[model samples]
Target: MKKSNEASCHNRVSQQGIKVQLEIIKTEARGWGVRSLNSIPSGSFICAYAGELLEEKEAERRTSNDEYLFDIGNKYSDGSLWGGLSNVMPDAPSSSCGVVEDGGFTIDAVEYGNVGRFVNHSCSPNLYAQNVLYDHEDKRMPHIMLFAAENIPPLQELTYHYNYVIDQVYDSSSNIKKKSCFCGSSECTGRLY
Candidate 1:
């Protein structure tokens, strides 16, 4: 029974891979973005955010800029956090913040990553990130899967909310600096944060 289940899982993964064909393209606003070569149905698996997996401490030390790091932490029912290779209960819920007990593990894609690296951020996005655990029970290192949140047309740029907390900075005059949002959505908040 275990073997049969494993085979079934493998087959499903293979099928998903066949349906996903994406390309990186230069955008007018965002520097680079990933686009679907074919129409993608809602709830379909797009691809995994592949990169170098690092521990919470190591990830923090290496992350000079927050450009390519993806937090994959899990939160237990008790509200405890675990990150990066740490064993987590199978029933634990995945946290969007990726906060761990100490720090948080991150997938650094700046040096090496798949097409997922080119996926730009939007306040209103057609894609959404999902924490999927397969081939392992560790939630701290679960696969960051991208899924189409709605039906996507061919050649449409695939985007998701980065959910980055915008930090307020003050100039010499003590005025707040606002970061501009280029998402171009009707519901754009005018700020990337």
Candidate 2:
């Protein structure tokens, strides 16, 4: 598009049904890219941020103020829960929708190995996370939804800003403003300045 930092974006696709897979490819200026496995339509819930559940207090305690939403208890190449979501819930995948604690909420873990974790960071991302209603009338599990921020094409790796939009929510916990632009998105501020 505008051509700012275009390295971080890639293609992704679902191999068979809802199980979308991530692949590494290349962009025009960006080298070594991973894109979508198929042509994903807009407004589609690409996949859940599946992982282990933990209480907010525990997550905060575990993360030691890392500022990451999900407490992965371990780090993956994809950047999943390295710790836990401090303000979220703590429990197993309960009915896909249940409170992990009073006033505390549960978060998806990459323990189940969801592809969404590897989506990576982008100042301008194609996908965005949406907290949709977790319906369990049919015994369905509650889950956070990932929607296309824009129309994603086939072979494009689905991506979202990993900073969690702390700036958008006015969250002062992020070090992004101080971090460098490895995402190389079109909107890469060059530096956090």
Candidate 3:
């Protein structure tokens, strides 16, 4: 079973997440997107969204407007981003000032990223991003993992909900910021962030 699964996630991609071979393809509208080269069963560990690990200050200097920045912050006991320093208070200022708090750590993949960066957003997605702690016991900072949320068939486009919290996307100039969605799923929310 292990060998077959390893064969599924090709070794050529990277030393990590070698359980499946993935292909980066061009989408007619969404620029670059990733597709599975083989079937991935539900609960399968896909790959880590590998990139340069960044601290908060450096992350701030780089660019908050970047699409490749991912938050891996300390979550509330309920697995939500809230330090709970005070009641209903933000743990730290979200780098994007959207709902995602940096929790002092963020992954900037704009320049150096793996195939995970190409995975697009979908309302009805087959995969999901998860926070996992493998190297250390610190739950505050964990590795961002991509797992098959459902049984994904061969040659299918891989997707995961970006899970951006809508209410917190406000800026002083714009009452609300939104990017149009082109996932084309019936459950499409018409907005990516």
Candidate 4:
């Protein structure tokens, strides 16, 4: 079990309901696009993920040998980054994205969960995940924040760059080279794996 916090800005359309409708698009390299579910102002949370927390070892052990797509990047003394993000376990089940050590807080229900998982990669992206520091009642634990990278219009699919740009720019090995992009945005580079 893991915990997280409230992030993302939401508009109340009705007393009983809140609606965010993001678009999905398919491109040549990056297959899916997620855009503003509505007209999103800057600094908004579209949606989030809730799931069983797994150590990198656990996540790796759980993924079958064939599921190459699940790989996140390096794991720190306490975390790992792959599949477009670092290993994030929030303090509350419903807390915003963050990491934890052996002992941290917990939450019962996951509020907005895992909407970003399906968002594919782009060399040129319309969306990005912002890392934020969350201050809590308990100062000992640290929290992380995620947000949309840019303002988006309705009906546009959301997207983020899958690879770190600095690594891409400085990496010398052909192995680390980025796969071409096919998002079909006017900026599409047209080659990806």
Candidate 5:
């Protein structure tokens, strides 16, 4: 493998002949989204969710009423995943160890992030987040790599499910702040969370 920095290039051609380049563009519905600039094959790495890493507690406190935080807690264990707008719950466990300690953390991309932050949500998305442990063996803070879940054509918007959990609390009127989905896919659930 190439150096960690080189391997994380946002625009480069890999040995597999897949062009890994992405661009951020305004979307008709989702405001802004990430689009491919070249054909990408299934399972090819797209880009890492680069951002400021924060401690679990600090992350929770910061994102309690925010939206740019991505939960990476479950990456430490082998069980079901949680965090983000997905399966996260009030009772989820917390960790204090840093990325090098194999402990949980969150990636806050509100002020500092890469193009990966622009990828929108889709009910039937063509991209997926894969926890990649490159340059470090710690699984808890693995690089959140966006990979093509299927063959992606050039100029196509890359998206993935935000995996927002919909439950009783979500149906309550108090949570009217939930955003709606405009992905336009037949499978569109109509809501972002």
Candidate 6:
């Protein structure tokens, strides 16, 4: 797999399963990454993307440097685009389908988050996000979850697709947003967004 600015990717085991843990590993060339301390089976729960949940307008009021915002407001065609990664991530867990509709909340974890924040982005990923509403019936604020898309070996770095659509996002300078993607998958798009 190719390398990304981040060394690992965030994952989840359950909505309230913060105890489900993995280890953070540092790579001299890749910085810090998340890795399984042991073997993980396919379709297993990893960890939830964790953070501060925000309303649509409130999230919009923040800066455009959306590196850690998870849009719990929209629906996607598949689990691939689940949670609509804005820039960064948070916590959730378990199996649920790809998506449904949400009220208008965004999860921001830049400062407030868990180990799940350590997970990285990949053009090709071993993890998948599923929106689950186990915590409350709000539906607007369902837990954004991650699960193993495939069985992972011990010490393997966890990764998931960021699902960014080229040219749709802009930076604070109003310029087209672009972050070099080093996640070495053959499907790598070269740019993060």
TM-score leader: 6
Task: State the lDDT at 177 in candidate 5.
Answer: 48
The sequence of per-residue lDDT tens digits that candidate 5 reaches over residues 1-193 is 5654555564332222335777889997678888888987876767777789987767756744455777766544433342321321245454432334444788999999888888888888887775656467766676777767788899999997776654421322345446667999998888876
Against the reference, the lDDT scores of all candidates come to: 0.69, 0.47, 0.70, 0.42, 0.67, 0.69
Q: In candidate 2, which residue ranges exceed 4 Å CA deviation? A: 1-34, 64-68, 71-103, 106-112, 136-142, 163-179, 190-193
Alpha-carbon TM-score of each model against the true structure: 0.73, 0.52, 0.73, 0.46, 0.70, 0.74
Report RMSD (Å) for each prediction in the order shown: 6.8, 13.8, 9.2, 10.2, 8.2, 10.2
Tens-place lDDT per residue, model 6, 41-130, is: 876778878899988777876646577787765543444453433222334222244455654788898889877777888888888776
State model 1's lDDT. Answer: 0.69
* Candidate 6 steric clashes: 27
Worst 10 residues of 2 by lDDT: 74-83
- Candidate 3 lDDT, 47-146, residue by residue in tens: 7787888886677666536578776654434444322212222353433223334356878889888889899888888877766655686655667777
Give the poorly placed runs of model 5, Cα more than 4 Å off.
Answer: 1-19, 75-103, 168-177
The residue-by-residue lDDT of candidate 1 on 80-149, one tens digit each, is 2222112213443454343335444689898889888889888888877766666776656777877777
Q: Quote model 2's TM-score.
A: 0.52
Give candidate 1 regions above 4 Å deviation. Answer: 1-18, 76-103, 168-179
Query: How far off is residue 110 in model 3, in Å?
Result: 0.4
Model 4 agreement with the true structure over 1-193: per-residue lDDT tens digits: 6443334223221121224675556654544445654886544555542334444444434433211222222222322222223322234233243343343321111222354555666666655443322334432222222345556677766666644343342122334444455566676556443
lDDT value for candidate 5? 0.67
lDDT (Cα, tens digit) per residue for candidate 2, span 1-193: 5653333322222211254455755554434445677776665557666565666555544433332344222211222321122112234232334323233433434344455555565677777664433244321223545666566788876666554333332224433334344677778765322
lDDT of 5 at 153: 91
